[model samples]
Target: MSRARSVRSPRPLLGAATVVAAVATAGSLFLSLGLGLTPCRLCWYQRILMYPLVVVVGVAAIEERSGVARTVLPLSVFGLALAAYHSWLQVTQTTCSVGVVSCATVQYRLFGLLTIPNLSLLAFLLVTGIVAVASWRTRR
Candidate 1:
């Protein structure tokens, strides 16, 4: 009697999460470079939080480790919070009040709708949600 081998790979959720993170990061990079939209201090902080996520998730996916996924989730969540705050500052006419770079003067908004911080907020939300879903799925 011959035994059948299992052909399934591990951590499908993690793989999907990593792909989303990579795509989000690359898309943001494209928007920044191609559109000549420079990032402010807050935007840079968001990028700092996001750029590593792509790497963390990518490595976790490769290794199929849920521990890394769990660890990285907090980073994305924090990024979301920061991006949201920055976006709010831009759209609401609030002063930066602290940073070396003033978020109030970036002037990247389009039709009073889309701003750099707004884009960052959206990206943060997307990445956080995707990673959170993947984390939940893998918790089983």
Candidate 2:
């Protein structure tokens, strides 16, 4: 009997994270600048957390860094939490009076369910998963 060994690389995962973050960032920018949609406070916060991942993850992927998760995981996790909270606010119809644009307002939806926050949540989730897998692969 012959035994085969499998090797996994973290670069691809990091690359994927970079792409996800880039797409999310572009989408947000397009919404705000191109479509003239005003972002709520929560949306701004989510952008703050997500915009940097494109550069961070891209660099890590290009360099094939082994310890990128240590830096990225915190941001990814926080973004995920914020996105979840924003989505919950929309779902529960909680009114936010902090900014001109209400956090709970659904400006647009992809399929009637995928609002901006939902998309952000999905992107953060994807980045979190990618970072986790990359970190784990490095450990092996």
Winning candidate number (lDDT): 2
TM-score of 1: 0.73
What range of 10 consecutive residues in model 1 has the weakest lDDT sum? Answer: 1-10
What is the C-alpha lDDT profile of model 1 across 1-140, one tens digit per residue? 22221123335656676776677678668767978666668777877888888778778778766677467868888888997787777667757755655777555555767876766677667766766666555555
Instruction: Provide the lDDT at 88 for model 1.
Output: 74
lDDT tens per residue, model 2, 1-140? 22222245667788899999999999999999999999999999999999999999999999888588988999999999999999999999868896999999999998776999999999999999989998888788
Backbone clash count for every predicted candidate, in the order shown? 0, 0
lDDT of 1 at 10: 32
Candidate 2 stretches with Cα past 4 Å from truth are 1-6
Off by over 4 Å in 1: 1-10, 94-101, 109-113
lDDT of each: 0.70, 0.91
